[model samples]
Target: MPEYLVAIRSGRFDLAALKNLNTQRKDQISPLISVRGTSLQDFDNFVDDWGDRLFYLDISRQPKDLKEPRQQPDKPQKINILLERDLNNPKNAYENKRSFYSEQLEKNKNIVPVVSWRANDPIRDIARCAILLNKGGEQAIGVRIPIGKNGEPSNHSKEALSTILNSLPTPEKCVLIFDYQHISSFPSTDEDSWIFKTLSLAQNDYNIERAFLLSTSFPKERPDNGSSMITACLDWEWQATLRNSFEILGYGDYATSDPDGEMDFIPGMPTIPYAGYFSDSHLIWWTKKEGKDKEFSKYIGIAKEIVRLDYFHDDDFCWATIKYEEIASLGGGDKSGYGNNGVWLGFRINQHVAAMLNLANVNDSQIDEEIDLF
Candidate 1:
């Protein structure tokens, strides 16, 4: 009998009841499916113990089970494919563990498609991440979109997306990272709506293998349509009629706020928009002082200041330091949204300059802290 594991919320699950459920599940299988409900720890133990022999179903965890199996393909039926969202981030050990597993899966001859979601990151890192998945004679299809400061998709961003989709074959089974807009100008200008339209066609015409759309911040004015992120994505799916084929998953809980605060925006870094887009028009805030005045005048001024400061390598904020005195001496009221003393500034300054920021050692170069601006 082939075995499987089901993991759920720890506190809500009843251990004794699960033991019986496992028995029931096993009996129900024609030949018998050895399905078991266990804690995350035990599951990890099983993978460690079974190594490449155990196939796993991590309902909400990364694809770690795939790693060992992929590394050793001789272990067939060792893993079964199930729908799950394995979000990879360098910060979390568990997340990294699963990512490693997925990477291993890509190497296997078995064609298992992985659907992943990542906040927008640096261009080089994005390319590197995609390349890893394509290793060992495997091809990974991906779609990326950039979210703006207001948390909306920029005009040019939409168009760049269209080019990628339009270029793909209609019935494509690809790995898409929802709302990853790293490259500046995707395809060209005046193609903003192309993304939405192409996606519609992808679901309607091409019958896309899997579709993942990253949603925007919910609008408080529309209480009836809360959960905009999920809502927007579903709306696209439904209208496109691709809902049947696609499963939209949220990496972060919709009800809860993201603690990392705009995981896509790297502190003290400038992003070149895709071709056909105006790169200079958008400003990326790297420090709290820079975000102080968000109005057009303030925003534009700060953008220019960053260019100058980054050019000169000033001492005050060169290494992620906050210029309290410069801000305090301004003697201005804290109406900029940050409270008095500028404690409310949104981000920390970066210390690296272009000369100092080296991407060779850091596999993940999206972080501003690791990269130098000068």
Candidate 2:
């Protein structure tokens, strides 16, 4: 039932090949707009002209005999496949997470970036990360709701989510990323069934278009089927049956020892950012929770060098990881990053806010941004 914009790569094969493919497909493909010798500019223009109506042709790069039915009669069964676990690569990580629910939330115009942190109790874990309601473009309204002693949503959180969703022109939108293991004790009903029940409530109550599960320890720690779940967090078991909730788990990016402690400047002096050794620093990857270490400060500090260019870099910009711990240590002598671990770094210096000038290098433009942490 799908039409296609069948691209005829004359440079590689003949036009008759596609006709053979159409024959095999029984003409399910239609209105094939042929393309050849088109430059990137021309292709863009053509795409703009076609807009949403244009569909892609699923052409195979493998050799085709074009003589008989594409499906071999002798080998009717598709080969057993083993999918690769390469989604953790920084370049493709965003895509891997986003594709999970692109179809369901196709109409919503904006997304609310959420970072759910693990906590000592149900209240603290829910209070771990911030809720960033996207304000049109590069700007966002950030809200960190403090959890009450009884683990209730603070007035601040209610106002933020309410005010944003009520005002938005969209019918459904919001990407709540729970960066922790679980919201253990929020509901007094039962221990094992709290997460699903709570999430089901959120789906019916709010305009949450989609949600990405960055991490959850329930399945791996308690696999009833005696199977490994941590290795594939996006499995069907972790998903809930909430009507409005389209949830997908992310690759284990934030599995770590420490969560919220800050790094101390040992002999500790902050350094300026530079160009060398940090050429690909525009994108930050935090698949683990160990970024407050001595080497972490050094590497990230160097990567945050100033670029005075007059444009934003969303195409290849920010990808921060929130986990079970803190971003930097705040205690006097603790570089261990667990000041009650809801200590998230997204509250501090994200890609939105460029690197601050190190007091050590106020006027040095080209020096290495190195630092020693306690």
Q: Which candidate's TM-score is highest?
A: 1
The lDDT, on a scale of 0 to 1, for candidate 2 is: 0.27
What C-alpha lDDT do the candidate models reach, one value each? 0.29, 0.27
For model 1, the stretches where C-alpha displacement exceeds 4 angstroms are 1-99, 102-120, 136-173, 177-195, 200-209, 212-374
Worst 10 residues of 2 by lDDT: 273-282
- Cα lDDT tens digits for candidate 2, 221-251: 2222212111222211233222124342211
What TM value does model 2 have? 0.25
lDDT of 1 by residue, 225-257 (tens): 111111111111122232233343212111111
Off by over 4 Å in 2: 1-152, 179-198, 205-207, 213-253, 265-374
lDDT of 1 at 81: 30
